[model samples]
Target: MNTVLRLATAACLAVSGYLHAQLYVGGYRVIPLIGPSFLVQASAAFAVAVLVALGGPFLLRLAAAALAAGALAGFVLSRTTGLFGFSEQGFQPAPEALLSVLAEAAVLVLVAVTLYRVRRGTRTVRA
Candidate 1:
């Protein structure tokens, strides 16, 4: 179960990271301010995915939680309140956006479960 969860989390992270990174080439031209932010997010997310894939590390778990939460928050804020004055197309169920959100949410869930199990001393997986 731990292995499965870890892999699933990593997969979601990969997808989310890719989506975030894609903004560099896709939307960054329209919003130059977001380019740097997308680069940082993509790099951090990919690094976290690699760490989680490697195995249990206390720091990795913390990073995973932080990155997932941050990604989700950024996504929601960008879609609703419009991050940096650039709002998304307005909650219209865009396929790409939906996929990214779902992946981020999954990562959040899996990472939280992993953290809980680790805290309770019941986790069999390293991460």
Candidate 2:
């Protein structure tokens, strides 16, 4: 169960990371702060995903969840108030924007479920 959850979460993160990397190389690598942020996000996401997949550690799950949440937050900010003075209207990046958002969301849910199951199993059944 844990392995399944971890793999799922890692898959999600990998998807998100790929999208970010594609975006960065597609032309976003010149948006000042936004460009650099994208690169960092991509790298970190990949690294975390590998770690989580290799070992379903609680800390790794937490890190993965945080990464996904951060990506989602960045997406919202970029579409809403704006991220690093950059704002996109109505998912301007086409499928990448939407797909990445979905992937990140899934990572969050998967991580939460994984963590919940781990904690639940550790409790003593007060029968």
Q: Which is the leading candidate under lDDT? A: 2
- Give candidate 2's error at residue 114 in angstroms: 0.7
**C-alpha RMSD for every candidate:** 3.8, 1.3
Off by over 4 Å in 2: 125-127
Spell out the clash pairs found in candidate 2.
none
* lDDT string, candidate 1, 1-127, tens digits: 7788887888888788888788666766456666787788888889888888878575775676677788778778887788888667654336667787788888888888877876777545544
C-alpha positional error of residue 74 in candidate 1 after TM-score superposition, expressed in Å: 1.5
lDDT by candidate, in order shown? 0.77, 0.90
Model 2: per-residue Cα lDDT over 33-126, one tens digit each: 9998999999999999998889846798899889999988988898899998999987779999989999999999998897778777768454
Q: Which stretches of candidate 1 lie over 4 Å from their true place?
A: 91-93, 122-127
Cα error, residue 93 of model 2, in Å, equals 0.6
Steric clash count of candidate 2: 0
